[model samples]
Target: MASVAFEEIVETFDFLEDWEDRYRHVIEMGRAMEPLADAFKVPATKVDGCASQVWLMAEIDGTGPEAVYHFKGDSDAMIVRGLIAVLKALYDGRTVAEVLDTDAGAQMARLGLDEHLSSQRSNGLRAMVERVRSQAAGAAEGV
Candidate 1:
């Protein structure tokens, strides 16, 4: 149930024979993202459980389960930033219900991230996913 953007990443990952190349591609994706404004980097948006500073500011359009989900994220670490970019592809522009329904762990597993990422990085990724889902759940409840 990955978005088209995320599917593209999966395809690219499949095409890249070397894990190192895939890793570089992820870093490139992070480099390509527009930096989150400093204004949105407040405590409210800061993601816990990350080794480096990270922020995720979600923007839900309309209300209820059908509301569209979007967010901007930034990280002090390049690899974490790349992981945020990956999360963006997975969830951005999707409806709140869709976001809620997504099996993020399974999707990320398709990229072999579970095997490749460090344990700390994996926990950070899970935290980011939780943050996104919590935001979507709030929107779904019209809160």
Candidate 2:
């Protein structure tokens, strides 16, 4: 899977004339996520701050110090699903150190995500970032 750039996301939205098309794009991205296995799905990993039910699982491999984030979510909100797709592309397959150092908030702002999103949606996005950051921090501490 290719990691989508902020510019690419903008171009994608621009290509679509209406919100319906944009929404379809978002849904398609969500559908692209790799499914979480039943054994990996745990309540403790669920992101509670989101209005929608969002589950995130992280696998850290010491071989190359790579971290993989697997996400599964269901929401009535289309934009939120798109936002999650963006995050999954960016953060998955990265190292804990890399994820901790990345300026995810700034990138999101540059994508105009906050401007286009409702307050609730924006909060949910931030919550996702916070959860990832927390996990990265724990891993860095060797917890």
Candidate 3:
């Protein structure tokens, strides 16, 4: 996956004329996400704070010295799905240490997501990040 920076996404959003166009862009982004296998589709990884159903799946492979993480997520909300796609592209196939070390919240802020999102959406986004972070931490600990 190509890891586009948060700044790029923010710039793209800024360039859009209105929320409808933005929503279309977001849906397109979400459509780019690789499909998750049925085995990875579980309720436990589903985000609870979202107004729509959201599912996240993560796998940590530690056969080598470095741990690698693979993630997939789906959401009923177009923008939220796009946000998950962004997260997956950024963090997938990355080391657990890399994920744990990265300031994801700061990245999201840089993306201007908090300013653009409704309070409920922002909370849902926070929940998604927390879930990923917890998984990364657990991967690092070999859990």
What C-alpha lDDT do the candidate models reach, one value each? 0.96, 0.67, 0.76
- What TM-scores do the predictions have? 0.99, 0.74, 0.80
Off by over 4 Å in 2: 1-21, 38-41, 63-79
* Cα-based RMSD of candidate 3: 3.1
Give the clash total for candidate 2.
Answer: 0
Clashes per model (N, Cα, C within 3 A): 0, 0, 0
Off by over 4 Å in 3: 1-23, 37-39, 63-65
Q: Find the 10 residues in a row with the least total lDDT in model 3.
A: 1-10
Looking at model 1, which ten-residue stretch has the lowest summed lDDT?
A: 50-59
- Candidate 2 to truth, TM: 0.74
Give me the candidate number with maximum TM-score: 1
Q: How many backbone clashes does candidate 3 have?
A: 0
Sorted on lDDT, best first, the list reads 1, 3, 2
Residue 76 error, candidate 2, Å: 6.9
Instruction: Arrange candidates, best TM-score first.
Output: 1, 3, 2
- Give the per-residue lDDT of model 2 (tens digit) for 1-143: 23455457767777787766766787787777555566644677677778876666666655333544333544445556667778876676677777777798777765556666778777788888898888777776676
104 in model 3: Cα distance from truth in Å?
A: 1.7
User: What C-alpha lDDT, on a 0 to 100 scale, does residue 96 get in candidate 3?
Assistant: 80
Candidate 3, lDDT over the whole model:
0.76
